[model samples]
Each structure stands twice: as C-alpha cells, then as structure tokens.
Target chain A: MKAQRIASLTFTALAIAYLAGAFFIKEPPLRQQLGPDAFPKTIGVMMLVLSLLYVRIEFQRQPVKEDDERAAIIGAEEKLSDYVDYKTIGIMLALMLGYGLAFESLGYPLATFLMFMAGIYVLDLKHWKRDLIIAIIASFGIYFLFRYALRVNLPIGVLKFLFR
Target chain B: MDIWNNIVLGFSVAVTPFNLFLAFVGVFLGTVIGVLPGIGPMTGIALLIPITFGLPPNSAIILMAGIYYGAMYGGSTTSILVNAPGESSSVVTCIDGFEMAKKGRAGPALAAAAIGSFIAGTFATIMLMILGPAIAQFALNFGPPEYFALMFAGLTVVTSLAGRSLVKALLATTIGLAISTIGIDLQSGVSRYTFGNLEMLDGLEFLVVAIGLFALSEVLANLADMRQAVMERLSIKGGLWLTKEDWKRAIPAFIRGTLSGFFVGGLAGAGAAVASFVSYGIEKSTGKHKEELGHGAIEGVAGPEAANNAAAGGAMIHLLCLGIPGSGTTAIMLGALLMLGLQPGPLLFQQQPDFVWGLIASMYIGNVMLLVLNLPLVGMWVKILDIPLYLLVLFIILFSFLGVYTVNNSVQDLLLMVGFGIIGYILRRLDIPAAPIILAMVLGDLMEQALRQSLIISDGSLGIFVTRPISLILLILAAISITNPYWGQLGAFFRRIFGQKTAA
Candidate 1:
C-alpha cells in the first residue's frame, strides 16, 4: 500500500522507457558491426532482467531484515511521515534552482544573499540577525573573490551602477 | 640508489616557491577540515578541487596530495581531544586517545601521534618512491584489451569489497556506465543518448556529477538530522616531550603499523580505515601492554595513527601507478586529473615524471608541515569544531554550487548536479556503494574504447581478448574477483555436504 517495491519497479519503468526511446533513436548507417544504440539496448535489457530478478527474490524472502540498508528499497513502504525531513531537502533544492534561474537577472549578490538566507532558515538556524549579516557578508565576499580575484564577469542585476 | 636522481628532480619541482606555498595552504586547509566534526578529508578534497582549476596540473596535484595525507595527521587531533573521530580512518584512535585525554595525558598522546605519523609518512613515501616506478614500468607492456580486463577486474573487486549487497553495487556501476554513454560517440561521431537537446550533446560534466553525487547528497541526508554536539574542551597543559617509556613502547608499534598499512593500502580496494583496524588488531595481539589494550594504552594511539598516515601514503601508489583510485578521495583526485586533460596511467609516469615525482616529494614536506602546525597552532585548529553545523552545511552547499557554476557557467550543470545528488542520496539509502559508480563513470569510455579496439584489431573476432596472454590473465583475475565474494557461501555449502556425508 505504501512505497514498497519502488526501486525494482522504478528500474523496470526506466528500462522500458529507455527501450522505447531506443526504438526512436536514429543512427547514421555504419560499416562496423555494433551500432550506437546497441550498447544502450543491451544495457537496458540487462537492467530490466536484473530488476525483475531482484523483485522476484525480494518477494520470495519473507520477514525482511530491518538492519539491512537494502530494506530502504522496499521498507520505505510505511506512512508518509516516515520520510525524514525530506521537505527541507525539497524546499532547499527548489531554492537552489530558483537561485540559478534568477542569478543573471537578480545579480550574484542579490541571488546569493537570498539563497543563503533561505538555506539558513530551512536548516533551522534561528538567529535572524546573525543569519542576515552572515548572508550579506558571504554573498559579497564570494562576489568580490570571483570578480576581482578570479576575474570572472558576474551579473549585476538591477544594481549595476554601483560597480560602475 | 637509482631513486636518488628522481628524488632530486622531485625536490627541484616541489621546492618552487609557488608550489611550496600551495602545499602549505593545502595542508592548512586539510588540517582544519580534518579537525572539524562532520567534514572529513573526502569532503575537504571534493570541496577544494574546483579551487585548483586556475593552477597548473603539477601544482594542482601537489596541493591535492598535500590535503590527502595532511588529513591523516590532523584526524588524530579530534580523536584525542574530543573523542570524536574526524574521519573513518581515525575511529580506532578515539578508543585509546580519549581515555588518555581523560587521564590528563593529552600532551604526550598528541606528541606520540605526531611523531608516529611523521615516521610512518616518511617510510611510506620512501616505499612509494621505490615501488611506484617499478609497477608503472610493468604496466607499460599492457595494451588496450589488457587495460580493459584489468579495469574490469578492479571495478568488480572494488564493488564487491565495498558494500553488503552485491546487486545494488553492480547496479550502481551499470548505471554509471550507462551515464557515460551519453553525448556523441567519440569513435564513430554517432550520437547515442542526446535526446535531441543540444545541452545533452556534451553529456554530463564529471565535476558536476561528482559534486552532486558526493557533496550535494551528503548535505540533503544530514539536513534531517541536524543537532548540536557540544564537545567538552580538552587542554594540552604539559610539555610535549615523550617519556623514555612512551618512546620505547611507541616505536615498534609505529614500525609494525607502517608496514601493515603500506601493503594493505597498496592493494586494489583495501583502504586506510581497514589498514588502521588491522594495525590496531595486530598491536593488541602482539604488544607488551596486552592488559592495557583499551584503557589509554599508548600503542593503541601510536599504531593506528601511524597506520592512518602510512595508509594515505600507500594509497597514492595506485593513483600514481595504475590510475585506479583505492578510495573516494583518490577518485576525486582522478576526476581532477581528467578535468586537467591528463590521463593517469603508466604513460603518465613516462610522460610526466616531474609531476609524479614532485607529488611524491610534497608528501614528505606536507607531513612535516602538519606535525609543525598541529603542535603549535592546536588551539586555533580545535576552534573550527565549534562552528555551528548549520552554517557549515550552508557553506558546503553554497560552495559546491559556486564551484560547479563557475566550471562551465552553465545552469543546466547545476540542475544536473542536484539531480545526481538526489540519486546519490537514494543510492546511499539503498546501501548501493557510490565508489563503484564513480569508478565506472571514469572508466566507462575507456573501457568501451578498449573493447572496440580489441575487436577491430582481431577483425571482429572477440577471441582477441582471450588470445593475448596478459588479457587472458586479467580476464581470469576478473572472473576470480566476481567469485571472491561468494567464496564464504560456497565454503559453507561444501562443509554442509561433507558433514552430512560423515553423519551418514
């Protein structure tokens, strides 16, 4: 009922996807025996077969050992809350993505500062004053290091005239 | 005697003012990170590899190699003072070192550890100098198929040796090979898995993958379990001189541990942690202080500390000679080599003697620097441990992001890194060894190229792999490696049959 058997199932799903994609992959005709798709197709089939084998063995073995780290494969089948603080990871990952996308538009300083503050908060750092100063200092510190020291032309966003 | 010439050339390169400065910086950073609680040498090297992008390859490796052994010298600090092992290799140090610290003998414990590490470091470096060229010379005879076979054997052996479940580890390795097949096929100019996207044409960046799979995922996993660890400060009050009794007991342990660590760490897959454990076990069994094995015995601290540093020196052999990394940190160094357009194999030694020998020389000076730094600046080094874990975590993630971004100035690479990081975290959760995947990814194209080249040479006959003596021997070794893990189960089955026969 939970997320049990996700790995084998996920592997099977990906293999089928790969095989279907392999069907569409165009190749320029070549004289050598093995084509470009040959290696990937073999690998996809290998993955499919091994994943099926794993699933079969998993089902056959009853009373899965809790100590087995492999149990995370099938054992994630508990409740939704069982996923430990994954929300923080998801939020932080999204923030990083946002930082990357908005980097050129928002400037390195602005983007880095925002990301740092968000990261600190998500990581459960409670001192807002300290976090703010640290974030500002780190953002500018890295900016100067890259701009002057390493000499990379970073984006300036809306506040471009300051450097000029 | 012949090594003296190489040593001279090595000193000529390493003693350059710039290279020496980088070595000091590397050791300084390495000791700081090693003295920290969660961040160890692997993380230190991974986080720092990007900074060396601006330097020459020779200077870069001198810096990286400094960090490598420098961590070994510093790891003993945390174990002795805080009872927290800074790295996995130093875990054995914590047992006796902490007890000694509790008994107000931290100064002598620290001194013995430093002295033992210095002696072992010098010995292992000498051994590496003597042994490395000989191994590389032997490897010069290898052709493509032999390389493939040797790589295959190494990959399988290392994977099987690393984790509990063979299936998961193999799966990780296979996934890495598949990832490596992305981008245009180099030989035929045929595109395989580009998926009609121009960005995908370049395939995945190795640095991005490394950062994601190692640095990013580690942050994600640890984010959930963030808690403050208040380490009670232990002071080194007494003089640094070791008593006659301390030196008498510690010297033999240092010798035994250094020899054991060197050989064990020089093997294909055995690493420093294993070397230190074996050293501790050997010390306990064969020492004069058998009854004082755990309760603050000087040999316990001395032996493992020596083993820890010597093992690092020993691990450099494979990285320098055969191009295979014995552990995760060495894999990062290999990634750096690839980024710098330097292929690391026998030819590297033949082609770049100055680079190789300079690296060998830097280890000697780096260890001495570590001993000097640890003794005088110990108070400053221990302060790094008190930095909030959350801030450290933020810094690591941000640093990783900046490093990947600057490498190519590509947002896509950043996205891909986060994706791989998540995958890495899942693999960690599933207990699939990540080392195999990194090894396979690094070797994937070369492996495929070797196979194809072998076939072409034999005019499409696969028998070329078996007909060549070296290749055949390597393939046999590969088969043995695959079966090595199952030997225990097979032995159990045979014993059961024999026991039943006796009963009947």
Candidate 2:
C-alpha cells in the first residue's frame, strides 16, 4: 500500500483504539457532569472523524484508472520512504532504549560509552578505535559536568567503589 | 513616572556585567547555530536550554530571547549562502538572496538582511515595550470566564492559521488537551490516565516532551537523508552600502515589513514564518519593481529578513504580557519559565518588575550585539557551518538526553523522550503539523483550570462564557478567527457567481 493510505489507516486504527480504551476508564463515584472522561471522549471522536476524512480525501484523489495510477504514486512514495534508513534507525532506537534502562545499573559513563559506540557503528561509521576514545571522553566529560559543575547527581552504580 | 522608573529598574538589571555577558554568549551562539542548515532558532533554543538550567529566571529568559533574534538574523545567512533556510521563517529570503549571491552581490544582500533585521528588531522591541505593559494592564481586569475565553480564542486562531487543514489542527489540539488530562485531575483530584503507575501520578514534565518532540525528532528526520549543506567558499567582501536605487526600494519595504511582521507575529500562533510569507506577498503587490522580485531584488531580502526578526521580537510581547505564548518557540519559553517557578501573566509585571524590565532591556542590547556579532564575524559563522551533520546529530541527541534527565532526573524521562521522538517522527511522516500539538500542550492546564473554575462559578452553566462581556468578545473573535482559513475559498465561490451576474 502507498504510505498515504497506510498513514490514513493507521490514524483510523489509533482513533478507534483510543476510544475503546476510553470506555474502560472508571470514573470517580458521582463525578461532575463534565467529568474527567469528557475531554478524552471528545478527542477520541474528533480523531476518528479527522482520520476518516483524511482516508476519504486519499481515496477521492485516485482516478478510475486506479491500478496504474496507484502503482505510479506508490513508486514515488516508496522512493521517498526508502530515505528513512530503517535498519539504522531501528538499531539507534533500540540502543537508546537499552541505554536508558542500563543507565541506573551500569552507570552514566559506562552506559553512554557503550551506547555511543553502538550508535556510531549502527550509523555505518567504521573508525571504531577513534569512536571508542571519543565515546569514553564524552561519557566521562558529560558525567562530570552534570555531577560537579551543574550540581546534578548521576548514579555511579558499581563504579562508586573505584571512584571513592 | 511609572514607565520611566520601570525602564530605569530594567536597565539596571540588564546592564549588570554578568547579565551583559549572558546576552553576549546567547547572541554569539545563537548566530552560529542559526547559520547551520536545517537548524533554526527553535531547535537551537531547545538544544541549549540545559545551559540555562542553573541560572535565575531573568538572565535565562534574556539569554533565550537573544538566541531567538540572533537565530532570526542567522537564518538569512544560510538562505544567501547555500539557498537553504535554516528555518521556515527565513524561507522567503532564499528566493532573491541566493540569486543575488550567484550574481556576486552576496555582500550587499547579507548586509541588507542584517541591517534591516537590526532596525526591525529595534522597532519591534519598542512596540513590545509599549504593548506588553498595556496588554497586561488590560488583562488584569479579566475574570475566570474571560481567561477561559481568551485561551479558547488562542487555540481557535492557532487552529485556523497554523495547520494546513483545520480538521488536522483540531485533532492535534484535542490530542494535546487529552494528554494534559493524564495525571490527577486538577479539580476532582482523580487520576484520569495514570493507569495505576507511581511514575504517572505526578504528570509528564513539559521539558521532557519538548526535548523529545522538537530536538530528538528533528535529528531522526535529518538523519534519514543526512544531506549536509554543501557551501561554496566565497569572500563576503563587498561594499555594505545599498545602491541609491536599492535603498529607494528597500527602505519602504523595511518600514512596511517591520509593521506587518510585528502585528502578525504578535497575534496568537502566527509567528515569523507566517509574518515573512505575508510580508513577501505584500512587498510584491506594493512594488512597481514587482518584475525585479524573483531576479535578485534587494527588497526581497530586506523585507523578509526584517519581518522575520521583527516577528521574533513581536512573539515575545504576547508571551510576557498575557502568559499565552504567541508562537511555538514562545510556548517552549513559557514551559521554561514555568520550570523556573515563575508565572508570566498580568501579575508578573506587578510582582517582578525587575525581571520583566530587565528582559525588555536585554532585548535592546541583544539586537545591537547581534549586529556587531554578525557583521564582523561572517567568516567565523561560515566556518561553524562546516561541522558534519552526523557529528551534530550525535551532539543533538546527547544534549537532549542531558536536558530531559536534568528536568526529571528519571531514566524513565529519557525513555519517554525517545518514545516521543519516534512518535514525533511518525507524525512528521504523516504530514501532521507539530506546532499545534505543542501549543495546545502548553496551554492545556491553564485552559482546563479556567474552564472548571468558570463552571463552578456558574454551577456548571456553559452560558457563563457568553454572559461576561470580555468572554463574549473573545468568543466572538474566535468565531471570526476561523474565517481566516476559508476566507479565500469563500471569496472565490462568491466571485464566480457574482461575475456571471455582472457579465449578463
């Protein structure tokens, strides 16, 4: 499917899913008439309408010579979509999440070092030695800046033994 | 007596050696990043926010404001040099700016943009100094219903002007309002969307959402292509003087653009981008040299550059006066102000006169400093743009992480920043405008609180919005504001029918 159609359908699905979840929100006993659910309920409905409108516009845009026209449009859209570099982006995202989780356990310096190395590798830069050195300097540099200069604490984790 | 004393107090705060240093640093850095392709004032401000984390509110705002107009001035450099607008606000400058550069007129073009921006910035700052205090005094008379109506009107204006489609803007606004309802209900004290998590109870930090949505998402979008701006090394040496004929065309445009940009940008949601675009169209129509516009017209760079800078100054007025941010960048500024535990509204003028006046005074100084910074440092600005995109992207991500962490000190906030980054990237792919979402998010709490309070006063009566004169006037303005989107289409439809009748 073309990205336009796929995007429209995705919003439609999102709106429906949001509304479905809205129904299960347990209100406080004897809440105000315009209760906590009112705003969300309005938003869900509006999202559904807007998404369907978007989908309608997309469909209405297609001519009767649908197959060939759609193929051409999809071809152009696919060319655009290929720019995302999804493999690298996915790796970058995964590394970030992992780094976030490991931040408390492995410490800011260590986790940032590993994350930066993994991130640079994912982006297809091959100067691993330089990257590692740079990453080490950066991680420690930022850790000290936040800890001392800015007076914010970054958890030291198991490295506290060595530093102390 | 009051205005004079206020100015004195403000100048006193701003003229301090420490504050002067802060303003210089802001403008200097703002100009450097603003010259970079694909990085405008918005992203520049977001990335550097952590630098101001430990500073007092007055100095912090002074620095951010300097960066704003500094970037506004810098955006034109990219347009002239590389035909790339660092931000949408400077998009119009590329039309004639690059043509002039190609014709070996880059020096005059750059000088015109800088000088026009300085003049407009000074003019607009004066207007802000006048209008900001006046508006705050007027708003002091407002009640809860009026406040609610004013916020609603703001959203209405934004929805009409900011988005390409009203439905899309509405959807974005509603989603933002919904997100604001996530934590414990302000009125009823019941958690709406917390879903029984301890972390969810206190609510999402605005800074986390901002860094995620604006800074991180921009990195992802740029990384998709990674096309660094290829700049040809060219000497910026040339006469700074506009030719006799050039000044004849440009001076009037500078004046007109300054006025139009100030008013348009001072309105809710219509920021520098809209102001410059509107100024471009107006400049074209008002000129006998319309033929010269697309072909290296100095007026083109003069008008749009001045308009953009003026708009930056104009945007600050509404934010400082009413606490309702007039544009997306100011909305982020509002969030920063909130984080500092300072409320910006009518009472702010009365309460913290020094802070308010000092910020105003700093704008005057910053505009002069930007002119000094840009005119002599063109070579340095050009070199700053030589930094590779991949390196900048990495630094952007790293700074965003630091900023989000600084705000909440939670690993969860970092993850949420990534989460919002991905979501923001998807929204961009879908052709959804992000400004409305951010604007609504910033306004959401105050909007809801005002509404509930008005309702409580009226025993849940919605008519209270219409009964109050101020509220009624605001609601009427909102209704009129929506006509902006459809006015052109409506005019054309009527013209078709009327033209047939006239021909018969």
Candidate 3:
C-alpha cells in the first residue's frame, strides 16, 4: 500500500476498533444511567468521524509528479509505520511482560534488574559487560532509593517469605 | 503593599537553606539539560517532578521555575558556540550569533545576550508582580466557550510555528488529540482507549513521551551523524566587553525586541519563537547597520535574546491568570501544579495568596541567580560537551526511569513510560512537531470539561457560548485571529500585483 493509503486505512481501522469495543461492552440498567461503555461509545463516534475525515483528506490529495516533488520526501522512504524499530519494540514488550509476571514473584530489585538489562540489550547498546553492570547497579540503586529512602513499601512478592 | 508583603514572605520562604541549595542545583542541572542537544525545558522539569515530592511545594516551584528560565539562558550558549540550538527558541539566534563567534566576536555576542536577558527578565518579573492579580481577575470570566475559542486561536497560530507543511502540523495535532483520548473519560467514568489494560486507564504520561520524543530521538539523530561532538577553541581572546558603537546600535534593537516580545508573550497563543522571529525581522528592517546582520551584528544577538526572554515572561501571564499554558514548557509546569494538588485559576489568586506571590517573587530571584550563574559559568557549560556521550545517556536514562517509577512506586507506570517512549520515537521519525501534541494532550481534558459544563449551564443549548459577553468577544477575536493570517498573505499578493501593474 502507498504511505498515504496506509495512514488513512490505519486511522480507519482504529475508528472501527473503537466502535466495535463500544458495541461489545454490555449496557447497564437505566437506574445506573452511566456505565463503563457510555464514554467509549461517545469517543468511538468521535474517532469514527475523525478517521473518516483523515481518509477523505488522504484520498483527495493529488499525488505530485515525480519531477515537481520536493526533495524532503524523495529519499525518505520510511513513513510512520516504518520508523517503529520493531526489534526493539518486540523486546521491550517482552521485558514489560516479564516484569509484570515477576512483579509479585521475584520482587522489585530482581525484576527491575532483569527489565533494565533486557531494555539496554533491546535498545542495542554495544558494550555488553558495561551495559549489563551499569543496568544492574542502576536498577538496584533505584529499588533501594524508592523502597528505603522514600519509605514507599514496594511489593516483595514471594521474596517476602525469604526476608522474614 | 500586598505584593511587597508577599515578596518579603517569599524571601523568608526561599531563604531556607534546603530551598536555596535546590534553586542553585536546579539552574545548574537545567543548564546541563538545555545544553544537551535534545533535552528541552519540558523534559528538564518533568524529569525533576518526582524529586519534588520530597520538598515543600513552594521550594519545588521555585526550583522548577529556575529550571524553566535557566534552560533558556543555557540554550544560547550552545547556539553561540556551536551552530546547533539546544532549544527551539534559540534556533534564530544561531544565524547571526554563530557568525559572531566565527569572527572572534563571541565574547560580545554572549555578553549582549546575557545582559539583554537579565534586563528583560527583571522587567518582566516586575510586570508579573503588578499585572498578575489584575489579569487573574479578568481571567475569572473565562468559560467553556472562551477556552475553546482561545485553544482554537492557539492551534491556528501553530501554523506559524516555523515548520513546513501545514497539513503535517494539523496531522500532529490530530494525533495528539487521539493520544489524549487514551485515558478513562472523566465525565461518564468509562475507559475510552485503554485497550483492556488497567494501566492504560491513566493514559501515557506526558513526561515519558517528551523524553522519548525530544531526548531519545535527538540522540538517535545525533548518532546517525558520524561526526564527533562539535566543540571549538574557547577563551576570552580580548577583554570581554562590548564596544561603544556596538552599545549604541544594540540599545534600540533591545528596546524594540522587548516591547514586541512582551506583547506577544502576554497574548494567549504567542510565544518566544514568534517573538524572536518578529524581533529579528524588525531589527533587519529598521537597523542602521543592516549590512552587519548576517555577518556578526551585535544588535542581532541583543534583539532576539531580549525578545525571547520577554516572551518567556509574557507566556507566564496566561499560565498565571487563566491557568492556560501558552507553550509546552508551561504545560509541564501546569502538570507539576496538578501533581502538587494545586488548582491554578483566579480562585487560586484569592485563595492561595502566598503560593501565587511567592512564585512571582521567586521569578525575580531566579533571574538574578541565572545572570550570576551564567556569566562566570559559561566556561563550565562549554566544558560539558566534553563529557562522554555513553555516560551522559546512561545517567539521563537512569534518572528519567527512576523519576517515573518513584512517582507512584508503580511497575505499571514504568511500562507506560516505555510505551510513551516508543510512541515518542515513532512521532519523531515522522517529523511531527512534538510540542503541539503534548500541549493539546494536556489541555484536552480541560477543554472537554469546560465544554460539558457550559452545555449543562445552557440546558443543552450550544448558544450559551456566544450568549455571554466575554464568550462573544473571545469568539470574535478567534475569528479575526484566524482570518488575520490569510489577510496578511492577501496584502502581500496585492502589493505584488500593484508593483507589477505600475511598472508595466
């Protein structure tokens, strides 16, 4: 698909998804008056209108002649979608998932270390030993700062037993 | 008398050893952040937000305001020494200021900018002291319609935001609106676009987005360029002072720039960038030494710096009076207010006299502190470029993540931070103006609330927007403001036509 077409379609898909979500959520009793679904329905309608407008604008724009086009976009093959360093994105998502899962099990320091190490690697930091060491130290330091210095009791999870 | 009393109280509050230390630290760190190519004032303040939880609100605000103006001061350092502007407002400064540096007149250029900023900043603080309460009273009348019209005016003027492609700018704004809808709806208590995650209920944090877009993306852009850091041979080649002729030429430009900037800065939608551009244009059009403009004119440095600082002061009027932030940096400051559990409105003036006056008083002190710090410390700031990029990046990332997570002690917020970072990266790659997006997102909720409240009062009649006198005036002004740009273009067209017809 052309860049403009893809952008238009993506917006349209978002609009449709919003509407679909709004429709799927069950309505509440009249006595309740408002519920979880009410706001979504309103926003879904707005999104649909905005998306339709975007699509219309995209479709109406005339493609420039090859010779007349500006130099700004000539060599710029990447559009919005192409810019998402997906390798990093995927790795980041996985790290977040790991942190979420480990939050109640491995505890703050351990989970934070893992997340930071994974993030540094995912972002493609060149130095392995340095990045790993720095990530660990920083993560642990942050954990102590928040848990001890600020006195915000973080979830120790299963490690609560070990500390006891 | 009240203002004087407040200043004394503010001085008493600010004189605390801890608060004083923080103010110094804030400026010093703010300068560092400003000098770092991608991290602007918004990021600097947002990064400092979590740390303030430990300090008094008055002290935190004092420090944050220091960061805000200090960043502006630091911005010119990079623009003067290197061609790169550390802040968007300083982009214009590079054109002539860098030229001055190449001609070995960097000392005079730096001195002019610093002194010009000091003078304008002090004047602005006084203006704030006198005008803040009066403006606050005027802003008390703002309703939903007025706010909508004001935002509309702001959004429309963004076209003049020193960028190409109006379509792209609007697209950026729409995307901002879309991002803003991600959190739960306040009115109906329904989740709009949370995508089934409990964490998404709060939406993406603005700080994460700012850092990712402005800071991380900048790092990526810099890394793409294989050249090592740009630094120059530094030292005062001669006595660091402006010549008599330079002074004679600069004073007029300085005054003109300050006046223009003051008005633009006070207006709802006007900001430093526009003020700087207007000042530069005026100086070029009216200066006695026109030939020296692009070739190292001292007036060039004096006028734009004065204008930029004046505009910064002007922007605070809206923030203080109507609780409207005219720019991205102010929006972050507003968020900081919210985080501190303070509502900014006219009632805030009547209710929290100390908070309001203390902040005004702090601006005066902060400006003085900035001049003291910036003059002798220019050499230290220049030395910052020598710091290894890897170490600096690690520290920035570490601090940012720590700040985010520490705010709520929530792992969920950390995930949101990362999400915003990715979103920021995507936005930057597409060349969208990030400031409008952040500003729109911040204001979106308030805009909706205002709209809804107005409707309720009117019993569902939309006519309520224009029924009120203030609302009607605002609507007319918005209409005129939007049309004025086109009229300007039309006048230029007619001028061209008449010139050609007469010649023929």
TM-score of each: 0.91, 0.91, 0.83
Ranked by DockQ, the better of candidates 2 and 3 is: 2
Model 2's CAPRI class is acceptable
Q: What is the lDDT of residue B38 in candidate 3?
A: 59
Where does model 1 exceed 4 Å of error? A1-4, A15-28, A45-53, A62-83, A124-130, B228-241, B498-504
DockQ values per model? 0.31, 0.30, 0.16
Off by over 4 Å in 3: A1-5, A15-164, B155-163, B202-216, B219-236, B480-504
What's the lDDT of the predicted structure labeled candidate 2? 0.79
Best by TM-score: 2
- Considering only chain B, report the TM-score of each candidate against the true chain B: 0.94, 0.95, 0.91
- Please give the CA lDDT of all the candidate structures: 0.78, 0.79, 0.69
Measured by TM-score, how close is model 2 to the native structure? 0.91
For candidate 3, the per-residue lDDT at A42 reads 65
Tens digit of per-residue lDDT, candidate 3, span B283-391: 8888898777988898888988888888888777777777878877887887777778776777778887777777777777778888888877787888887755555
lDDT of 3 by residue, A1-164 (tens): 26556765776797688678767654433323334464456656766775676567568766433212221211111222232344444544565556655764677667767766766655546777877777777766666666778776666665576567
DockQ of 1: 0.31
lDDT of 1 by residue, A1-164 (tens): 11336776787687677767666556756666556666677767766776776566466666344325422221211111234676777887798778877777788788889888888877756787888898988888778888899887667786698878
Write candidate 1's Cα lDDT for B282-398 as tens digits: 898999996897899999989988887787888788788888776667877887888888888887777999999999888888878888998877778778877777787788877
